[model samples]
Target: MSKQFFVTFCLLFITFYGKCQVTCSLPNKKAFETKIDSLNKIDLDSLNPSQKITSIAETFLGEPYMEKTLDIDIKKETVVINFTGFDCTTFVENMIALTKLYTGDQNEKYRTLEHYASILEHIRYRNGKLKGYTSRLHYFTDWVRNNQAKGIVKDITVEIGGQTYDKNIDFMSTHITAYDQLVKNDSAISAIRLIEDDLNQTPLSQIYIKDISKVESKIQSGDIIALVCNVKGLDVAHVGLALRKEDGRIYLLHASQSKGKVVITDKPLAEWLKNSKLNTGITVARLN
Candidate 1:
């Protein structure tokens, strides 16, 4: 992708209050089409559909987080759609919004760029208390747990290649897109390390999978998983997505905010649970 495209993506989320008018009904499947319709109702008709997808993604970057609504779409599971600055709730919202593209479809499994508009819903909150609003964003874990509870989610697990290990060891109780399992583990970690940890170099992507089996075993076929790690006991860490795998090696893709969107990489089936936790002694959790 071009830097301009990436730049626009970042800005879209940043300029949420700048002049965008959301005019669609909330929570309704029709909201997807109408949300995109409002955008198309704009003067940017010259842009193609892909460009439009990027534009839509960028437009709702930080529209706050609504606990009951999923109104923003995170890029195809490959991208974290996260910057350290982008709080946890927004991640959940993005996931919902992006899914609008694939909602009501049976064959769709991964995030596709084709359904960009269906992902956005026109709505907002009058206050945190939640009253009459078009959107309802769920708390990250609550959202996932609820989805899992409601059957919208199949299960959560760690995966690489064609193999998946779903078991709850230590990290199964929380929700977060692990930096390692996130977009491109090495890339997300490297970029985050540069921006946050101030580290100079990172490992090539080696890991241990003791407890990972517990987590992967439960992950439903279409669910997204996060990977994380740090030193043995310290707290600093990296995160990412374990979208899926090919053959036997788990292939991953993520948006290392610092590195930009959806880049591909690979790792062992359980690259994060080296010593039963994220290899670096980090923590792992599911994303809402």
Candidate 2:
């Protein structure tokens, strides 16, 4: 057999039979592959979706919190995946993506880093396609809405007695410097304005900090927790996952920008919110 044909045959062979782990080599593949390999080292076959997510999140408790980990300096936007460090949004999204990939039949096609990238593309982008800098879900509210609409998660905030909160979300367009991609791209800024305008008109709901105690029992492990803020021009201030500890209390497992590390909050969920001056309330999205 010719050398080139031999290599192609091996690649084709693995595509069909390699169903044990994510092995596709892509940009930042080492970090991404390490995460998948860690999860695969154990038999996660018995855990449910929520359990699977929390289980994986707990393994990264002390990982350093890195801001703008996905900030690409390129002229064109690309899907950036890094597991070594995480911001609040990436941490929650990573856990969600891992949970989705970890569950289901092992024989299914989630056996490569490329598959995880595909899953992240769907969860991170609007309508599951990366268009440009503007296509990413910059706001947690919009993130929840898009992912929920895709049946990846269900918004359970209102069902748990969350109250309506009137607010406008245009922070990304207004503060372009916060995102490197928007700084030079006027088109990206304009596109974000349209998204912000739509979100401004939409009514948002959240569990008031005072009411969180009432719905504390309803919040489950692995649920996406977005802290709704009272800040003008912004919706959620931070994002995390709910970690219901063995003692029956829910805590925030998140990439803490404040502490610069991933941590499960020392205080209970409700108490943590009550003490948070910037956080006014929270919106919950349960994994489907």
Candidate 3:
């Protein structure tokens, strides 16, 4: 089917189901369908959630890194499915969404592109509803916290030797010009400020950089690894899935800004964190 027709179908589906009105963007529709088809053929029954995450994540190994793909529409938000390129957050979110498609009900009705978009919306938006630009889970900690409440994932940072991550999260509101939506939109800025305020009081925890090595053995493959930032007013600087290589050390499988593509870190995650001044620690979560 043509991309236009597919998008129209998605719109009709969403409207018929009383879902939030949103545009769907699938730049590579054939590629997406092929991916879903291939994944559907896999025996996911044998694999655990972590294995399923890594199995799906490896498919985007060399995809180009593209920042701000979600900012396609200034006046409205789009359910964007871009297989061609990804930022760190999109890569991790899509990985979980795809895994959900397979692990969810086996009925054919649950495997359509619209269904995939629903899964993505659930993972990306707060409380699984798309009200506006501010509704997106811009903060990684908030994303984990909300998803954990829905039984999608569990924050395991504290269990693996994490300490309180006490930093005021007002980055987006403070740096308004950096975001186009927040620049001229007073309501968007106000919504973000409120979100930051709530997050600051949410009581977050992270594994400090100095202690990452001590708990490296406990972090499993396919665990979500959020690079906790030392920068002012920010909660997370980067995000990726953990991959325990044959060398028995966990490496970051992420969309690398430096490489301009998706890649596994050349060194172990602990050593990788040492190279960055902005990154102070990590917050780990597991798919439930």
Candidate 4:
């Protein structure tokens, strides 16, 4: 879509769903717009969707890894989009939202921070509607599933020989106190329990760490990579974009909590997988 059409979509979306929206407050909102405007000035019309996403993600390489970038006041559950900082998941989330704005149907444009907010609401919520805390796509697997269902991405794990494993999700509700929003909201807690129950009824899959090396060449840049964990209740512990360097090696471009900033992994994909004992494997989703 073009810039004019994107602005139209944002206006229409807000007008249609204003009641369910949360107040978006960003201190550097204008600066972000300037940044995006500058990015738009680049000759990216010839690039594919994945290339656009990769280029966008690379721009934030040195951004600090601020934990809880999404957590706002407990009473307001807005779709938070912060360029000032990012966690691993938000890093992928923003890149995907920006990619959609750049390449979505040729007529789309994000003219303001609210436009980005609308894009994020669609990307981060169930059925693209921000109803409440429960509507947030908290789990990476659920995020993949919802976005894929909306035709935003496609799960390519099975095509790459991923094997099905028992699903064991429930971390959010079980550890309710850890989340500020979920602690006082009983309704939110109940909704999460339902989501967890549904997740438990299904089988999930991933490409085992042992097998990532075998298909490393098939991995492409801008592909969303979820680092699966061996933890009892979680499907993924971290996420990032697959960045293929000129040396023909695929490294992870992610927000490193350890380093307190975003950085591309020094080790290659397989070697990096070996570095984390908690990393059981990986699940990949390609943006459409």
- Candidate achieving the largest TM-score: 3
lDDT of each: 0.33, 0.81, 0.85, 0.81
Candidate 4 segments exceeding 4 Å error = 1-26, 104-110
Give the Å shift of residue 233 in candidate 2: 0.4
TM-score of each: 0.35, 0.87, 0.91, 0.89
Mind giving the per-residue lDDT tens digits that candidate 2 earns over 80-197? 6676688999998888888878767754355666677678778988998877768888888888999989999999999999988677787787788977777888888889999999
Which scores better on TM-score, 2 or 3? 3
Which 10 residues in a row give candidate 1 its minimum summed lDDT? 126-135
Which residue pairs collide in model 4, if any? 1-105, 1-106, 1-107, 1-108, 2-106, 2-107, 2-108, 6-109
lDDT of 2: 0.81
- Report lDDT (Cα) of residue 88, candidate 3: 98
Candidate 1: segments with Cα more than 4 A from true spot:
1-96, 105-139, 149-151, 154-209, 213-221, 228-241, 272-288
Clashes of each: 54, 1, 0, 8
**Tens-digit lDDT track of model 1 for 56-95:** 4444443333221222433212111222223333442344
Candidate 2 total steric clashes: 1
Q: Identify the runs in model 3 with alpha carbons over 4 angstroms from their true place.
A: 1-18, 22-26, 107-109
